[model samples]
Target: MRILYFAWLRERIGISSEEVETAAPTPAALVEELRAREPRYAAAFADTKAVRVAVDQEMRGWDADLAGAREVAFFPPMTGG
Candidate 1:
């Protein structure tokens, strides 16, 4: 799977994107796997509530399945003034 990070997520992880191999069934599971990879990933995914996810470029909840997803993006929720 191709994982993309944005804004502070990218800054924290120290990369814009990465390819991962996993058997995770859901987005939250995938996050747990990534977080186990290193401290940087752990920091980036520290607070699930503060993060938003997109699977295959479409917004989804943490419980959303990642089956057949080619891209998964993590970013902070947008704020409007």
Candidate 2:
């Protein structure tokens, strides 16, 4: 799957995007896999409640299934002015 990071998450992870091969079933599972990869990923995903997820460009809950998903994006929660 292709993963994208935005805002502070990208800054912390030190990358805008990457392609990953995972057997994860859901967004939450994917997050756990990424978090175990390294310190950067661990730190970026430290507080999952503050993170937002999108699967194949559509916003979804952490439990969103990732089966056949081609892309996933992560970012901090947004606030409007």
Best by TM-score: 2
Q: Give the alpha-carbon lDDT of every model.
A: 0.94, 0.96
The per-candidate count of clashes, in order, stands at 0, 0
Candidate 2 global lDDT:
0.96
TM-score against native, each model? 0.96, 0.97
Q: What lDDT does candidate 2 reach at residue 73?
A: 99
Model 2 over residues 1-81: C-alpha lDDT tens digits?
A: 899999999999999999999999999999999999999999999999999999999999999989999999999999999
Q: Please list the residue runs of candidate 1 whose C-alpha ends up more than 4 Å from where it truly belongs after superposition.
A: none
Q: What's the C-alpha lDDT at position 26 in model 1?
A: 96
* Model 1 superposed RMSD (Cα): 0.7
Q: Worst lDDT window (10 residues) for model 1?
A: 62-71
Candidate 2 error regions (>4 Å): none
